[model samples]
Target: MKTEIIWMIIGMGAVTYIPRMLPFVLFRGKELPIFLQGVLKNVPFATLGALIFPGILLIQEDIWYGILGAGAAFLTAYLGANVIVVVLSSIAVLTLYSYFV
Candidate 1:
């Protein structure tokens, strides 16, 4: 509600928005090479792995908890489930593990 907070939010929005817009603006009407396009298509998966792998490894309460969750997610993803399904399947598996154990 404060003026400073409003300006800060606007500035942060612009900072994040500009980079996202740049790729579309710069690449519009330009064809990327097939190999580059393929690599770019996998970027999100790579980023998600990088973010989640550490948490999976570092779970302190019980290592099997992380391992089982990751295993479920990996299997779901390997079977070509959507990303949301992969996440939900992992949660479902972990919930069952907790309930039964």
Candidate 2:
């Protein structure tokens, strides 16, 4: 059993190492194509949209409430509200809306 666990740990380490090493090995001293760079620049937004959009639309309750809360949080953040204020304001708005309407 101890031997098995040791081998398992080594196997997992190799698996993790290969993924981390592959990108560096493949991209070393190489400039990405312009199109690829553009795609990469959009990747973060695409990832965020993919993650948030479905949750915003497909939850058990109405989508508008979640959207409104997100909008409020974003507005507050843009206005340079502190993180606590932004979080609290979002919660307050959502709670009030849920309670009253």
lDDT of 1 by residue, 1-101 (tens): 89999999999999999998999889963389988888889999999879998898567488889999989988999999999999899999989999999
Supply the global lDDT for candidate 2: 0.84
List ranges where model 1 is wrong by over 4 Å. 29-45, 59-61, 79-84
* lDDT, candidates in the order shown: 0.89, 0.84
Could you tally the backbone clashes for each prediction? 0, 0
* Candidate 2 lDDT over residue span 1-101, tens digit each: 69999999999999999998997889853389888878878889999889877675554388778887888888998999999999999889888888988
Give TM per candidate: 0.66, 0.55
* Minimal lDDT window, size 10, model 1: 24-33
